[model samples]
Target: MKYNNPVIKGFHPDPSVCKVGEDFYLVTSSFEYFPGIPIFHSRDLVNWEQIGHVLTRESQLPLKRVHSYTTSQGIYAPTIRHHDGRFYVIAMNVSNHKTFYVWSDQPNGPWSEPIIVEGLAGFDPSLFFDKDGKVYLTAGAFPGFGPEGIIQAELDIESGQLITESKFIWKGTGGSSPEGPHLYKINDWYYLLVAEGGTEYGHMVTVARSKNPYGPFESNPHNPILSNRSTKLPIQATGHADIVQACDGSWWSVFLGFRPVKSTKVHHLGRETNLAPVEWSEDNWPIIGNNGRAEIQHNGKSLPLGEPIPWQGKEEFDDESLTSVWNFYRNPQKGSWSLTIKQGSLTLYGQSSTLNDYESPAFVGRRQQHFNCEISTLMEFSPKEEGEEAGLTVFMNENHHYEVAKTMKQGKSIILFRRCVGSLWKVENETEYDESIVVFTIKATETDFTFSYTKTNGELEVIGSGETSLLSTQVAGGFTGLYFGLYATGNGKVSTSPAHFEYFHYLPGDE
Candidate 1:
């Protein structure tokens, strides 16, 4: 059976994976969102289960800068490597400007606290363990103007320190900003894989090889072994790859790419994880995808298809805790949300901070995995005063988001459809509704997002609509995707009434 691209979808970017025997574990960069570094497990590579996050406690991830409009400046590129039965995840927190790592005996686990890599001065840090028990740290300078090239250093794995001087390895094939480096020893030759040309439309994967782990590496003869630049392919920004030799002895690569809106260069769903087959060249270099390019649907070698992951869109609040897919904007405020208080519903106490504020409001969201999707939530909220609101939102950053909320305006309970794009904010529509409970729905198309709500008569009424491009990275200028979520806010005062959401049902159009 053939496999599809983006084996994992929606906002998951910079994928680094490792195979632990027949089971594969992968981790992606989680910027600004708490419970950072989401870990996944898969036995057949095609089916993945989100086991948990790498950082669960605030002590391990001190992210004070999270509750703000600081942008996508938290955790950057992450590389997950397994060595000698221990799993290590190395990443750079841009907010702290520190390259640190956390280790665990199991992939989904109670990982150890953060251990800062002293003297490892660069972003996109990756760990490579050689056969001789020597550990090497390779990374690219921060994502900036000039290409400082990839740097390498001998690392003390246990002490979390750099034992050797940081040396500049290959400058890349003259690509600007060569980063996301992962080094591997294949067939007695040290192969270094990296993403270059920035993470935009020009993104690409290039390789170099050296007989020694660190030395004057020779660039691949073809160079840029993988890229989709200048092509009108649906999958763009394809780079930042990690190759693995599967149990069947076949090589495959996991990378990041984005699906633009139909006939448009806007990708509001963010970069997603994609898979491609890999083959070795006659010259010993690696070949990725279809001659250095991947497709949305790939017809590679047929393997035993794994069990299908059942698609259940209805989200019930029956669990004692939220599942692995739910994430907050940052560190959620204490007492802002509770699942125990409402029994079969989620209770969110509205905070004074709004979604437009530089602080955390009561918001819970999951990634918009499909471009064509529908989200509906049954919310019961009685607005006690003006500015107190609870409803659904399509969010990107503080500057860009769309909301269909139930609030009190001019002492009248009403349904409000507001859009926040850049510095401009507008209430596109509002309808007076006397009911305290209503069902809200957001229908996302490739071109537009439709907002609607149910009236007291149980009939749905369209309130407003928005262009999908407005929330895209091209127009919004951030490293994140769209999130359709439930939020509660008092605008500037603590809400007197808590919003109880019975359930959130999401139906993706892709299926």
Candidate 2:
């Protein structure tokens, strides 16, 4: 059964897959986002379900300096494996610059405490156990110039520590930044797979092999076994891959890729997860595409005809807590946000007044999913002080954010479209309002954003719509995704004005 490109959609990237007896489990990178390393269970390698998250507790992760411009923190690419009744996952938490491993007898685990591996200085670390029962760790390290390449060393299986000396493997093909290395053995050769060409438009996967586990290896003549180079397939970044062989011996690869929306002139879906089949050549080298580069289109390979699971773009707060779809930019203070099922609404408490403030609290948001999606929120904002503000925002970083806010101007409450350009927050547009409860909706189409609002009025009307590229990756120099959050701020004293979020609805297409 041929499957679509993104086997798992929305913000899941840097995929690693493992198979055990008919069961397949997949894990992906969770940069800066809490509850790091999402784990999924699949039977056919095509259809997948999220079973759990690996780093759910604060002690398992170090979150300081998490919301910086780089926004790089928490866990990176994670490698999952099942051996001797123990399911193990090893990953690096860049915030503390350490590699850690967690193990459990079951795939859905009561996982053990993290075993930290010291002296490692790079990202995207992976562990591989050979047939001889020797555990080897491979990772990508920067030599200060650019993305250096892959390094391999023996790791003590019991202690989760490095044993043998580290050795350099492939330094890339002289043109790309080689990272995300995965090691495997087929026949007598140990294969090292590396991603190069950066994670942007030129992203690709290359393979090299050696007779010995630590080697002088040869590059695959069919290098770049998979890529989306030919068409610039809207989804620009498409490398950082991991491979798994299904129980039936069919080969499949899970990797990271993304699609950019013109309206946001930025990516909202984040780095999505993609799946493709691999075919081996007569020479034992892997060839991914029938034509040349990897294709996103499904070719009806091996999938069930069951109806697609309907997904929701909107969320109701008729629950005790937030759902998995709602995630904070960094580690959240539990008491800061809540939803009372009986009250049937979300409450965000006032904290800091500005987005630049580290404690600028009162924030609950969802990942911007589609390029042309519509998001509307029912909100009641009551601000107390002069600089106190509360509203809805499309947040990129501390410095890059756009908001539609209800502010207490003079004695009256007014709605304004505010933006943080460079370092200043400016009121670019505003409308005088008298309503106590308001409904605000932001329609993002192709790189354009339109702000609209409604009171007791029949329907909302657009306040202003303009071309804005508020959603950028770490390139715009922040590690945060474009978030739709309800925020409240105060000048010095905490604002007594409470904000109620009735509901948040995000529709991918106009419905």
TM-score of each: 0.97, 0.90
lDDT of 1 by residue, 303-368 (tens): 456886776678889999888888888788898999999899989999989998767789999899
Per-model C-alpha lDDT, please?
0.88, 0.74
Give each model's clash number. Answer: 0, 12
Candidate 2 local accuracy as lDDT? 0.74
Error of 2 at 102 (Å): 2.2
For candidate 2, the per-residue lDDT at 215 reads 81
lDDT of candidate 2 over 1-511, digit per residue (tens): 4556666766777889888887889888776666667788877766677777777777886566643445456777888988887889999877767788998888777688899887665568888888888998888875683448888888888887788777777776754678899899987889898888887767889889999877888988767787776564655667888888766667777888877664323565578887777788888988665533656665646533244446666677887867666655566655556676238788776665456655435677766756678888888776656666678888766677788888777777788887775566677888777677899889887667888888777567777765545446743454335667777776554666777888888888731
Q: What's model 1's TM-score? A: 0.97
For candidate 1, list the clashing residue pairs, or say none.
none
Regions of model 1 farther than 4 Å from truth: 66-70, 143-147
